[model samples]
Target: MDLQESFINSPDHHRIPLLSWAPQTPTAVLVIAHGMAEHAARYQPLAQWLNQHQVAVIAVQHRGHGPHCPDADLGHYADKRGWQKVVDDLQQVVVHARKQYPDLPLTLFGHSMGSFIAQAFTQKYGDQIDNLILCATNRVDKPKLRASLVLVRSIKALRGKRHRSRLIDNMTFGTFNKAFVPNRTSHDWLSRDPQQVDRYLKDPLCGFSCTAGLWSDFIGGMLDINPRVWRKDLPVHLLAGSCDPVGEMGRGFSRHVTNLRAAGVKVASERLFEGARHELVNETNADEVWHHILNCLRPETHSVTE
Candidate 1:
């Protein structure tokens, strides 16, 4: 597999970093949108795995993420229009991938926060990609989300856009660790594997708090995409962990699938890993997760080629 790094110049002049892995003979292309407060490099293992299976992978780091982002801050998509700009960044990456490999069928894979972006992207550009994969995501309750946004916005107004609010962070993520009481780390909710949790904790970019402005923008984006009509014919695959708090232990995942089906979407498949956490790709049973994903991507094949 060949691994490469490059940068794309967004129209707003923000330099977005991308990491890509390609095999000698590729069968398909997968573009990844990573979850919040993390960089594209974290997905290297997943990318390498896909590459070895004759799939090319390209992953983009959001505006406030990765080492090459112009700003040194850990989280802040932008002072204004941050969420839209992130969506635009995904569009730009998709255009680039299409140009680079016009013949390969393209699939968009997103996890957690990235899954929200992927849903919005499909609503806007459903025709651009052949399939969609949403992992570790749920259909958020609009009322509660709006209330949280209002509170965050008020805090932003008082402390300024760049202010990082531990209050907001706690309100959003504090309870996730509650499920694993006597946990070794605050991020134990991320995976069952202690090594993965430790690695994430040690990574400077993995667990930082985002600016209030980012929270406001993210909530706004979530509200905007929640009610919009999605294309009925788009093929979608939803994956979640049975123990993932974000998915409400699979209840939210089921509701999301029901919503899509109600909207006339063709949900190709849905799977909930019984013992996994929020980050399915990094779980102890990650190989099983990958097996399910491979099956979804290549339904015609019975087994993954070595």
Candidate 2:
């Protein structure tokens, strides 16, 4: 099915594009937020599957990540401007969806950096969604790390160039592609089958590098969404890849499952696939991943096990 994208005009008429797949039976509406440097179109497969099962999907391309990004440079998000702008844009989309699908069950799905936005969105718009799903959600690190990033950026600024050094930023996290998959060809982290990774690597928009400031902003944003700061008691589901480098906090997430339950929130479920990488929804075993996700969206199908 083809997706229809609409330009959302917010104040400056920033064209925020949206993709929708209308379902025949119309069980629910899944609103998706893509990770850093990626557009919303990548989630088309998931949206198509959901549509077949009588569910619609609406995906929003964040302010600076789309083809029409305001800042064509790397360091735009190093500051809070880009991140906050995306959050507001996402909220606007949520409001728009509620108006369009008032009676259907609304589910918010986020991956990686998008998960941070989804969690933050839940805090502000908790009553609007029935279920919140976060995949490959990054956890906060020590305050010293945050300070170090600031110091590094300050030193770079002193050199007379704006933004942090791209080399340093690349060394830090760009190595993630290597860490998670070892050889990008050995196995596709997104799917259980080898072809899935092949498709991802071939996809022009799948992965791209971010600025040091953008990296710092992302980590800081996750800190802001830590379950500690999570105030929404809505049904929440956390999914991470066991072998995924981004899933560094799998054990930590398990350790704190009780805390989430005590907060009047249902853990609904938390799953860590044996060797799945960052993007579970698009994994080779996506059918399995999609099953669990749909289960979370439907209260009748909720299961504690993966």
Candidate 3:
């Protein structure tokens, strides 16, 4: 396997960082869109695993969340059109990956916030890839999304987009830990592995509060999700942990699946792990999760219903 890292130019004079891991002869290309408050490097282990399976991996470090970012710009996607700009960054990475491996089918895998971006990407640019994978993603209802966006906008107006609100932070990242009382750490909901949780906490880029503008922009992206925009031929896999608060503990996945099928998606497959949490990729049963994902990437003759 070979590993490489590079930067690509995007709009607004911003440079997006990307990490690539691949085998000598890859059968497919997997492009990963990482979650908020984290960098693409965190997924290196997973990428290496996929590389062993003869799949090339390219992970696009989202704007404001990588090691290359300046400290002040760590949580800001952009000063304007932040959501669209982030999506555009993903597109740039996809174009780069296409150049590197033009003949292979590319699959987009997104986790948490990345899943939201992937949703917008597949809708506007579904033809760029052959398959979609969404993990630990929640159902987006317009009423709630609109309300949150409005609230974030109001806060931004009062304190500016660069401001971070403890209230919003508590409402989100803070609330997620409530289910696991007497938590060892604030991020216990991430996975069942204690060491992995520690590693996440130790990573400087893993935990940071997003600005109000970023939140508003992210919600706006979710609101912009129009089922009709998704390509019917694209095979989509929805993955979530039954204990994940972000997924509303499986309820959100159920509703979201219903929404996807209602949109006339023919090959939308979903899997909910029995006792997993938010970050299934980092969980104790991650190997099993990886195998399941590999199966999904397999040919029609293989079973993806593990």
Off by over 4 Å in 1: 70-72, 226-228, 302-306
lDDT of 3 at 95: 93
Ten residues in sequence with the least summed lDDT for candidate 1: 297-306
Highest lDDT against the true fold, candidate: 3
Clashing pairs in 1: none
Assess the local accuracy of residue 208 in candidate 1 as a C-alpha lDDT between 0 and 100: 84
lDDT of each: 0.86, 0.70, 0.88
Instruction: Kindly list the per-residue Cα lDDT of model 3 for residues 132-200, writing each as its tens digit.
Output: 999899888788778878889999999999898998899888899998889999999899899999999
Per-residue alpha-carbon lDDT of candidate 2 for residues 1-306, written as tens digits (9 for 90 to 100): 568778777655566788888876786888999887677888888898878777889999875566555554433452445566667778888888888889988889989878878877876667778888988874545574577667655744664333456565455446455664465563344455567667766765545556555655555565565464454557789888776666563664454355566655667788887777777887767888888888888858556344
What's the ranking of the predictions by lDDT, best on top? 3, 1, 2
Candidate 3 has its poorest 10 consecutive residues by lDDT at: 297-306
Specify the poorest-scoring 10-residue window by lDDT in model 2. Answer: 71-80
**Model 3 lDDT at residue 26:** 91
* lDDT score for residue 218 of model 2: 55
RMSD of 3: 1.4
